[model samples]
Target: MAGTSEMIDLKSTPHSLVENFNLMKGLLATYGPDELQVLREKAFRNFTEFGIPTTKDEEFKYLSLRALEDGRFAPAYGATIDRFELEQSVLGPIDAINVVFINGEYAPELSSAHALPKGVFIGSLKDGFTVYEEVILEHLGKIANLTGKLGSTNDERFVYLNTAYLTDGAFVYLPKGVSLEQPIHLIYLSKADHGPLVSYPRTLIVLGENSDAKLLESYLGMDGVYFTNAVTEVVMGESAILEHTKFQQEKLESVHIAATSIHQSEDSIYTNNNINFGGHIARNDVNVWLDGEHTETWLNGASVGLGHQAIDNHTRIDHAKPNCNSFEVYKAILGDHALGVFNGKIFVYEDAQKTDAKQTNKAILLSPTATINTKPQLEIFADDVKCTHGATIGQLREDSMFYLQSRGIPKDEARGLLVYAFAAEVLEKVTIASAREVLENALFAKLKESQDMPEKGGE
Candidate 1:
């Protein structure tokens, strides 16, 4: 970490900002002139409102950005990456097209396209700006309206900062009538240089009409006090079908804050599975907007919290038209003195007379030191809507554990087996078979790691 003087000087005049703006300004000067101006205005506003987050803010009650105030971090400049580094920083055995982003910049040289299905276009958002500017312009900031959301207060600062200083990330666009069997994977790796640095990864996905595809996105941060502020937006066109999975496994020394927005059109089907496993402070905000009638959406997630880390999942499902349906299930396994928070909100608009929504949040405390806070809510403006929301936090089922033990398994192994079964209900729902195996292995390993951890209450 830098000293007080060094921190002050760095924050006051960040080299990353200077380098990024110059590059972006030059890029925008060539294309997106109008959008560039708008981004500048947004950045100025964000800067005015952002300094550091305190405990009083409800959205940030469990997250503190004070560690970021030291100001030794900057948006990464240049690719400056090695293939070995990419392989070491990521979770492997991946048999799909891999797009790598080092400190938020796309690294095609390090990425591979050998597994991509024919006709699938995967490239950098910056490069796409030159070739697919219209699509990028049409969808950029469409979900993240910097005017009213939770992060909007500092929109000028963070939004503008990201927009003006942004360099690269994955851009996935499935042309109309295209169907991809293999998943397109995007990996965001944050390299901390043994100090306080941040990586802002921006991802955009567009599925055209009658298109079908699956996406696997993951985030992993190396040592040092790293921060991952990522924003992902997905749009599904009418009659399109998409299955998206996101896995976040940053290290314990990292702070991760991510926002995912999904928009579904008429007769479209969208499924999102998010599994969060790491990070000292991990918070994910997911918003689903059902704008078309006869649309179907599912939001499922499982999180594991250990040590003193806090993981929060805030989800919102909005039914804007009639005959839309949504189901949300989030499960958490808490260990040590960790904390898990789940807030699920379902909104049925007046016109959504036949909207159907169900939400459930469940948690299992492995140790007395673990804590879980869950709030499930439903707001129905339409009297004909059918909605249900519930939350449950408890230990493993003793009867199930006893059954396993009676079958000759040891006590601890039996307990673990039952716990795995409890969490498996949601895990089994993961669409990709290969990804499912990887997730299962990771979850079991995490459970084993926390099993030996000292329980605060010693159950």
Candidate 2:
């Protein structure tokens, strides 16, 4: 172990995680070959070096891992879930190829049985390495690794943890010039049927040149006290386009941590829409490196927090090449004693003269006790660039509420409609019709659950 816990006290470290990591190593290492085992060992060094991050760590300042440190959560490598239940639970209002994973392990029997495109490949990472070993080797760690450009202090802290304990996850690959008419839905079901559990979900997606695809991923907690630490890596070839949407609908007792790393090639376009509605403690981080010129990126997110839950969104867009354009918009709705945090940073390199980046973060608190902390930042070394960042935090406008109530709407209806409209701005960004429908339902459903919201702070 190279980097041990130097920040937090060793006595207060995440003992359970250390134990689980050691236990899973011997068993899970057999899934992959020796090459991967060597890589896993290398990652373990980074994990021990950084240790589990504490609230004191700037990267994890807003969210605390005290709960995880206090309790012992065994790793879930295999779990049995009902097939019909998976369909009724996660496949709501979507007709697409469904890839189901239970407790981080791929469930092939439950996945879509239809035939895929001639040149496309979709299966478990476990199977991908067997069938497409060359592609897996070339791009897996290239986009996201413990010792590489992608391995920043913020990434090393948790990403290495996932790598050290990783088992099996989804793997998707699309060949050049192939566009699937239907989308791919990845459903992750975390079922702690036995006791408290922790699952680490890993994914790697590679899109070849001039290809296009739409992807949907959802994290669901069937029912139990559990934690999910998930990581996704994307490799986009020149002129490739991908539309990705993520839905976080875990149980309130579940904690969810998600991180995504993307590498864009020239003329590539990547758009992501994140909708967070559940999880007792949910934090999502998305980092995009526009390494190629003429690349366009759009990052949008909407989060709804109620009760004593907490939601945090952190994103970074690195403009490494010139002539790149990136747009980011994030919105949040908090009620009761919940908390929301957003930190978005955009960095432009010296040679990235034609970089045009814009970021906007807005939040609405529906209760006097609800709290929101937001920071939008930009760092530019190029003088001939257009970069702007702004954040707004406030409650519902009285004038707008009055306008709605004076017409035909009641107070509760008016308030709900206002909140709905506020969130719809980002929800409308979902391009897939079925996925948008699912998000719309979750948007209004979460807002309704936040009813009886203690009056908006000032009145």
Candidate 3:
């Protein structure tokens, strides 16, 4: 342990970020759980091997980590947030099984407490080690391709960083033949009380055969400099179904990065809708694998970037078996010098005959200075598979704007309406009614605030 701690490459690590290494070392040495010691060490070793990601890496070519690396970020603990503030952060009133986390520590008092059905579990990841020992042991590090595990080398460095300090997070499980009528909401709130704060939020979800459930994860933090690095892994049994949504509204001055991995079995279905409204430097990496025949995957997302914020979304779906299908659609709205990026990839294996896959990404830039970078790729080795991918980047159409203005709407309102309709195309796919309402409200509000955007074509 001492050797590995000393081996952490300092050259690649920033001076202020070294405290995190020391913090992880102390936590592991003093009171780390016995069952997870090896996993923690392996994850730390991976971080030691590669401290942080830079633009030099192909995956991070367009995204920059300067703001996150140079800041002094210490893990925030026991943060006391007001009930009113917590309530206001939510986009809408959704009667969900709410689980609240204040600065990465589970807050039972703030969360909704209820007894789930038999063979189902919902609680913090810390207690889950004992409460759901067998399930945790089996699927904890299986998904996300733990870079922490030896002999593995492909992953964004933050995933390993989050794993090394993964003590508390949200965990949910369902046995065969069970279904959850109410969606589970994991709400995270962050405050930089002492100084620039840092928190790692981790999650693991497992679904048994023939079971179905819905999950939503939301993040909203106070106006301060902070970093939220999160990772979530999911596994679906044969014929299982899951509806997943992630709502991120971090303050534009903060740093946020999340990686989500999903594995689906035979006849299973998985759907994801990730919405991003605010963040100084936000990045979402979602990966899915269709490991069984007749499985289906759907991925949709929308991002609104403003005020120099850099928001990036990277997604990949792999068809490994026959008769599998996958679809992805992502949209973005950028203004006031903001930067938005979208990269989607689909891979169809040789054995994945009869596979169908499609991917599309579109972005609307509202200012001459605002920018959008999009790349859609498809790789199909199977001769009988159908695969296609495309991306489009452009400003608002003048014809539509004129039509709306000539009718009765103001220029700003007309622009907002046009942008809203474009983004709502993707958000409308969210299965939860309340969730869709919340998403639509947030999208319009974001669009409304940027009404001063230069006229179409930067008049």
Judged by TM-score, which candidate is best?
Answer: 2
What ranking emerges by TM-score with the best candidate at the front? 2, 3, 1
RMSD of 2: 3.3
Give residue 71's lDDT in candidate 2 (0 to 100). 50
Which regions in candidate 2 have their CA more than 4 angstroms from the true location?
1-6, 9-14, 90-93, 145-155, 453-459
Cα deviation at 81, candidate 3, in Å, is: 1.1
Query: Per-residue lDDT tens digits of candidate 2, residues 186-249?
Result: 8899998888888889989999999999999889888888989898999999999999998999
How high is the lDDT of residue 89 in model 1?
45
Runs in model 1 lying further than 4 Å from the true structure: 1-34, 50-52, 69-71, 77-90, 114-119, 146-161, 451-459
In order, candidate lDDTs are 0.74, 0.82, 0.81
Clashes of each: 6, 3, 0
Which pairs clash inside model 2? 3-48, 3-49, 4-49
Please state the error at residue 313 of candidate 3 in Å: 0.6
lDDT of each residue in 1-459, candidate 1, tens digit only: 111221223334555433445545656455443775676556544543343345444545555555555545655544465777655543655667788887777778878866455545687887777767888779877865434422211212234455544446778888788888777888887777655667778888999998998888988765556778788889899999988889898888788878888889999999888888889888888888887999999999899888888898878887888999898889998888998888787878788998989898999898888888887767778899889888888877778767877888777767677666666677787777877877787777677678543221212
Q: What shift in Å separates residue 100 of candidate 2 from its native position after superposition?
A: 0.3
Q: Residue 324 in candidate 1 has what lDDT?
A: 93
